[model samples]
Target: MTGPALRPVSGVPQRWITVLGSGPLPGRPELVADADLVLGGRRNLDAAGVPADRALVLGPLAPALDAVAALAPASAPAPAPAPAPAPSDGASATTARVLVLASGDPGFFGIVRALAERFGPDALDVRPGTSSVAEAFARIGLPWDDAVVVSAHGRDPRTAFNACRSQRKTAVLTAPGAGPAEIGAALLAVPGIERRLVVATDLGTATERVEELTPAQAAARDWPGVQVVLCLAVADGAGGADGAVGPMRALAGPTEGPDGWALSEEAFEHRDSMVTKAEVRALALARLGPRLGTLVWDVGAGSGSVAIECARLGAAVVAVERTEDGVRRIRANARAHGVDVGVVHGSAPGALDGLPAPDAVFIGGGGADLPAVVTACAERALRTVVVTLAALDRVPDVRAALLAAGFTAEGVQLQAARLAPLPGGVSRLAAINPVFVLWGTRTAPGSIPVDSSATTAPSGDS
Candidate 1:
């Protein structure tokens, strides 16, 4: 009547499967046994504090059935093996007893779910222990409820990375490959990621420790058996851990203004070959609308003026140029303007590859391949494409390039008048040659038109 095994009313013979209770004491339903089957504590049942007459002890998980077999009397026939655990499908019988061995707590992301699925949810019995994640958080003395928890095992690391990058606090469950080092490497590559703090190599019986490390340093470190990693940062990480806020600088608009752009020519210190004339740049930037949060690319960035202007307007910008001399000028210009403009010492389209896709692109030099770059940007659906062409013949190529790239292309011819000395007594408007401003917004229909409108026409910078 107090047998450990249970045999339903209908089955082949009266054979049954035995389930064992874990770790400590009895009266905890000790073990379930059949006529000749033993579990939990068999020969040494009494030593383990269970009555041998009724208790059957199966050994560890690997040889559980073998332990029961050796303890049974040779003359007794073995009971039918518990129906090869029900199929994984939920349709399996709802009532069954199964054994599961777990370190710490099986309920904490361990074998509990597997047991529940095989035996049916209602039949699951649990033996709990401290969860790994819990131990990890405790080891670091950090509260976990407010933390975003993610598993990096076999899952794309981006989900966990984004959680840590965007949230103020996050706990990452690491796998062998996606551990502290991998996560650290990615965070290091992100701009401004240095302001965040990291906790790596937590949990496990040995080598358990916690400390602060910059993402760059952490990613470069070699770590072993680290179960969890944590990332925490203030929402505005512009000020580093020491809390020093840096100077403010803009490249495109008045150094200070809201929705600030439409910058004046005097705002830039150009002596002035590298400067894109203010009036011409105005129209180019309108079509481009290079603003913060988005990314813009400027190729043939003479002084890096346009790219810096874009960066100042709030968008991340990168300038590409081939001349080492031009490269130096661009960097100097970008620094003078106090805006962070990435400079690439290479040519267009090709140099743009491998970089993050951009929101807009400006081709200030690729006159021959201007159409090709525009076509590629349009195919990728960049938000905008602006090209400044000075040669009379280059205008047709620029217009055709924009049109071929899925833009409702529009253009303008600008000429500016400069004050010239008239016999040293008066000043006269000296006519500057015309420059072509051809651009298009590679946008969906109903979007704002690419503004190629200009105030004055001049050759130097119309």
Candidate 2:
């Protein structure tokens, strides 16, 4: 399936093949060659439009696509599972002229990729419908082009929540457990974010409805038939777009990872207690490998140096600290650096719950029970853990906990000396105390990957 590229733009409509929901059929679906239409689910969509009897009723999808979970049309029998292609199901005359009926835009986290991943050139077609996501945004009357959209179907909900919480605007395609209710609750528990939750339930249906509430209010409400959610951050205006005046540019697009991290001391913001030393920050980031579509935590984010830097590298960070004053300092630092950080005002462990699950976590403070907190992060299977320690005594305990959790451990002791002018013209090197940085990447067995898709097809939300 991998080739020069899946050039949907260049392909002619007549030659392009795609499956779609009953609503908003593509121009090519009718404009192309005779297509075999399998009207499988609801019949509310008119059968009158099809060339008489040309439409085949494959029956209702009960167990077929679980989203089509309720009773199917009264007229049809139980639907059979649409068998995915076997190795024998190759691109030959036997598999010619294909089209499958999907409840929504199959490409919007549906069956289209099953086709795309398995099929080759001129072997696919697509006509997208207004997904549950598009419908959600439409109900709110908000322009969606500027929103960061994510899907929570068969995937962890944290990445989706983090995207919505950290960005000024976002739309999430929800699954049963990861729907509006769960997303709202997660955001509510976050320390530094304020959001207005909107859930568009049963969109484009008989009972279609929209509801708005505070994150807390939304969390406590009942949700049903909710297909999409827009959990927009309350105030980082003009909506994070291309060319926004921020250091977030490096993370805005796709890029490969860098090798050999532990950068020099000059790369960050510091005012004595202002930031994590750059050498340690680099080690932490390398272990974390924070990038687009990943969530990270910088517990006790003092100057927000690590958290802001992670945001710049394309991760959504939630910086948790105990003091209101510390929160202020982090926010100010975040603004100056041109990145987004959901700053929380609370101490560790106690404040950690309700926050979205992180792909990696960096703990710059907290305390002796810090090992216990790290243990909790491991329990959630956080992909990476990086802790900076000033006290040598705690290193052994931290190392033991990481090992117990099955993570390979590593540490670096970094010390930097700056040139300072003495009373006269002569300069003397002044050394800072060496600090030990402990870092661990979650092993394969511990963490799960996001349902990520990268397209060479130019940048469009769709």
Candidate 3:
């Protein structure tokens, strides 16, 4: 048998790559002087007063990354471990020294992560600047400890929009096409959410501009530089008929989750025991893992019990209920629990169309189109999908649907009974109806070769 090929050894020493922050760069003359290559954005390099000959403009990240990689040491066969080197081993012992320039804190959703991933954490030295979110918050004199920061730069803006819709305070890093106008328009489109938008552009720079505007005003303007938006939730009476408002709490979201989940049947306003039993809900919530920055869907939300509970746990929730009475009960339960659950007055399969994708889904009712509804939810949910069924006949069909949709399927039957008072002051078990909780976790798509000849290409979700 042929011997295994040996791994390559990188002979380069731990040379420094300082990532300088943007705008009037902090004094680090020695580091800059030692740098053989200085890479940064055009504005950042100019502001730092780096020589044109030494500076490389960072345009497309791919090309820039390639340039950076070329500076690494050449590969050779692996060598045996050696003792620590002497102090005489200086800058000559390592590869070329590179210094990178970035805006704000490079460590926070910036180039530091990319550099670390490319050249390992030991190869870098980072000098961070005040994050843009902090500067924006400071400009408006608002406390940011409780503020949630999300980025729409080079990624999906829907999650950021969802964060703004649910959270009391949020800061969004804007991208070229996904800037204030796009984000504001999206928020304006969603009903039942009232928020004020604050836009700060070129913060801490010579051309700094900050403006507070309604969603309509923000959607009408054009923003041309680096910008951030602070989405602040409007108080109950800010624009209500009465000018009175509730006291602002220290924390925007709950400091901790509720004392208990899967609360008593009486806790929610349901019609004719339409809500999922407390025992089953507890198990479902455990599987859902609803929390910050996630969206959960409660399909066939009879009383919206699951949706309301999820909202209480700090998740942005959408409750889909077809009946007029179910919708009213859901709204009432949400209000009673001091939580916000977006109630959709429509049936599934048809209703699930325009809704934002969910992190998890709880199907309490599927109506006539159970198969289609389950399939739709499975396709959209990012993490887990939990389905509740009272009929034993539906078990195999539900399990098969989950398995076919690339989820690892499993289930359990839960039957609970409470101690009831007997006529003679004795107690007896009060048997509750059993429920089957069928759940599935999306399988991690393995590395498989793609065939160009195939009609359909593989998707990220697939």
RMSD after CA superposition, every candidate: 18.7, 9.7, 8.8
Clash number by candidate, in order: 25, 6, 0
lDDT of 2 at 339: 63
User: Least lDDT summed over 10 consecutive residues: which range in candidate 2?
Assistant: 453-462
Candidate 1 vs. true structure, TM-score: 0.46
TM-score of each: 0.46, 0.69, 0.76
Candidate 3 error regions (>4 Å): 1-15, 23-34, 59-97, 116-125, 154-158, 185-190, 216-222, 239-255, 396-409, 421-426, 443-462
What value of lDDT does candidate 2 attain over all alpha carbons? 0.62
Ordered list by lDDT, greatest first = 3, 2, 1
How well is each residue in 1-462 modelled by candidate 3, as lDDT tens digits? 999765322233553566766645444454456677788767767766788877888755666667777776565213435423422422223333788877788787787777778777756656577788888878877767667787765555666777776676778887655577876786665545577888888787678989888778888988888568888876676642111123455664323468888998899988888889999999999999888667889999998889888887878888888898898998889879877677788888788877777889999854456777888889888789999988888888888889889998999999999899999899999999999999999897322222231221111000
Q: TM-score for candidate 2, please give it.
A: 0.69
Task: For residues 286-336, write the lDDT of model 2, one tens digit per residue.
Answer: 777877678888887877778887877767888888877778878887777
Candidate 2: misplaced stretches above 4 Å?
1-18, 21-98, 103-108, 130-141, 205-207, 236-274, 335-340, 343-346, 349-356, 365-377, 417-430, 447-462
Candidate 1 residue-wise lDDT, 249-342, digit = tens: 3432122323555465566554445567777787888888764335677877887678777766756666778788877877776657655566
Backbone collision tally, model 1: 25
Best by TM-score: 3
Task: List where candidate 1 sits over 4 angstroms from the true fold.
Answer: 1-243, 246-272, 418-427, 443-462
